[model samples]
Target: MTTPTIPGFTRHRVRVDDGVALNAAVGGAGSPVVLLHGFPQTHLMWRHVAADLAADHTVICPDLRGYGASDKPAESGAGVYAKRTMARDVVRLAAALGHDRFTLAGHDRGALVAFRAAMDHPDAVSRALFLDVLPTLDMWGALRGVSAAVGFHLYLMAQAPGLPEKMIEAAPEPFFAHFLDAWTRDADAIPADVRAHYLAASAAAVPSIVADYRASAGVDVEHDTVDREAGNKLAMPVTVLQQDWGAALGYHARGLWSAWSDALRHRTVSCGHFMAEEDPRLIAAEIRALADR
Candidate 1:
């Protein structure tokens, strides 16, 4: 799949461990900072913020495995798409780029991967930022009534493997476009060309994408449960930008994140789920703040 060129950024196919080669956009010259994209979109989602961050820091935005031009390995029934594995891919991707340690940020699905990467390899992540997401355990724990109804996609994608994949493959555009349109407060947040690219990329990666979501319901939860039981918190400074799901779901949003990070800065943004695209300046400023701290 072809990704639109981000001005001033060079693209590379960096091979991480497990034979996974990630399609990454690399630029900048200072401290290393990796930006991970979420579902239904490639690293292109970070175009604006990445460009801004590149002015002062090394900005590396990579298409997560099973998305965009990245390798889509078949599921090994071992939760290969689990955030733990995906997180490892990020760690190795950074190391391959000669960064033994780096600041990190992720949105949506990528946020989960960032969270895991921080938890599992605390030494490798200097500071972490999560955009519009909750821990797998908190996510499941918070779902009830209307919240559960709105998150139907989570359940739909978590179903038995073949069915979800088959259904998504049947009508790729509408299925993929649904999230882009529904999640964004402004439909124009994603332009026509970018939306088309997302739909096409998502259609091609149906099986792997579904597997990623499937792993969330299984192995991802198990990992989170273990972390919770162990009383482990992220060892780095963390900043979370969310959509005030707590207000909508009748819970405390920032309070939820505080449990997982000792150094926590959580705020609810007014943008849609695609906060980076909707408000790139805020996202970039937040990352810069984390780096400054």
Candidate 2:
């Protein structure tokens, strides 16, 4: 059977960085919007919302550097998987696709990349939506004590090389499946085929995936922290959608976002972490609202 993809979208292997090519699905017309996927899944995670937006705008969904059909380069250094590098791949991807500027929407890890892109190259990103994530600098500060248990994987993958990659590769399926099973609020949202696709793809990407998380614990935090101290901020209109982890995590989600955005609309939702899949219509509508602004 052929792989499942967003209906009507055409796929392309676009090289956005040196020796790195991102597998992307591009469709629709009019102004452009790029959708970036979260962990343990491919761009297919944006299928529902992407299809909805394609009816009115050009939609481009690309698997991040180390995920899905994209090229997974060996982690020669901390910069390899840093979101800044990944974000540059995206800016170049849009330019290579003939768009000088586009609205962006990213979830989880993807959102973190989008967050950096908006900050570093504000002129190229017209507007953005970041879903279910805290900026890296803020995330480390937020996790503490027993409440931090929910993010055990973060600490696990953050360890120095060799060990983290070996531990995950030993039983990749179950290791990846744990998040797939735990994060979704509705099982029907992923379905069986999509879940299988995510597991298979993630299983094959253990090393690169571990490098991504490891960068989060090291270089990624450095980039965000340096920018934070410089007082760099997003120049575009910004929208943040998150499952209210504030009360349980002892931090205010809106307050954290406000520090980085002057034009921010932060919405706390009941939908699971994978809000794009669990509530596609709301996700699509929110993207439309933000893109329009």
Candidate 3:
């Protein structure tokens, strides 16, 4: 596959762990900040935010294991795509890049992964930003009747039999592009090359990506269950930016997040689901506030 470039950032590949290689772009220089992208997107989602953050911080944005130019492996079981394993990959990636501890932020699926990272490696994450997602347990617990029906993809991909993978592979572009187009408020914000790169990556890693969603619905929820039972709230300061999905969707976003952390600051952004890509300045300001905390 041809390498797609984001202006003002240099891309590099780092071996995060066995069977996992992350495509990362590094820029600027200061306290390290790792940006993890969500579903159907690579690190390119961080283009605008990274450029500005790099001016004041060392911005490390990596395509998560199954996304972008990163290693895509066949689905074996729940272990490979579990947030624990994915979070470990990030820890190793940071250590490889000479960051023993750093601030981190994640959007959508990436936010879930970052939450797990903070839980698993508390000492390593200085601050965390969760964009547009609830804790795994809260999310699943909130799902009911129509709510569960609306999030059909979660249950669909998490099916025991390999149906979602087969279905997704059948129409990769349109299926993947739907999320890309729907999430972003501006279509042109993500350039053609970057959009194509995302499509290519999603097509190649359909199975692994499915495995990730499956794990979220299964083992990842188990992890969150255990954490909640133990009363494990995030020790580090956290900032959450999300759409008013609670009012729109019948779930209280801020109330749910406040239950998970003592030092939590939550805001409802007017942007679409893809806040980082749709509104970088707001995201940057939130990150800066989290950094200061």
Model 2 CA lDDT for position 181? 81
What residue runs in model 1 are displaced by over 4 Å at the alpha carbon?
A: none
What lDDT score is found at residue 131 in candidate 3?
Answer: 93
Q: Please give the ranking of all candidate structures by TM-score, highest first, separated by commas.
A: 2, 1, 3
Which candidate should be chosen as best, given lDDT against the real structure? 2
RMSD after CA superposition, every candidate: 1.2, 0.8, 1.6
> Candidate 3, residues 87-205: lDDT per residue as tens digits?
99899989999998999999888999999999889889999999989888888877777756657778888887568988999999999998888777778777788788889888988
Q: Give the TM-score of candidate 1.
A: 0.97
Q: Pick the candidate with the highest TM-score.
A: 2
State in Å the error of residue 89, model 1.
0.6
The candidate with the higher lDDT, 1 or 3, is: 1
Q: Scored by CA lDDT, what does every candidate get?
A: 0.90, 0.93, 0.86
lDDT per residue as tens, model 1, 1-293:
44466789998998886678999999998999999999789999999999999999999999999999999999877567999999999999999899999999999999999999999998899999999899999998888887688888899889987888888888989998989988999787788888889999999999999989988899999999999999999999999998877767877878889999889988878999998999999999999989877
Q: Kindly list the per-residue Cα lDDT of model 2 for residues 1-293, writing each as its tens digit.
A: 35788989999999987899999999999789999999988999999999999999999999999999999999999999999999999999999999989999999999999998988888899999999999999999999999999999999999998998888888998998899889988989998889899999999899998999999999999998898999988999999999989989999889999999999999988989889999999999999988877
Per-candidate total of colliding backbone pairs: 0, 0, 1
Q: Name the lDDT of candidate 2.
A: 0.93
Q: What is candidate 1's CA lDDT for residue 221? A: 96
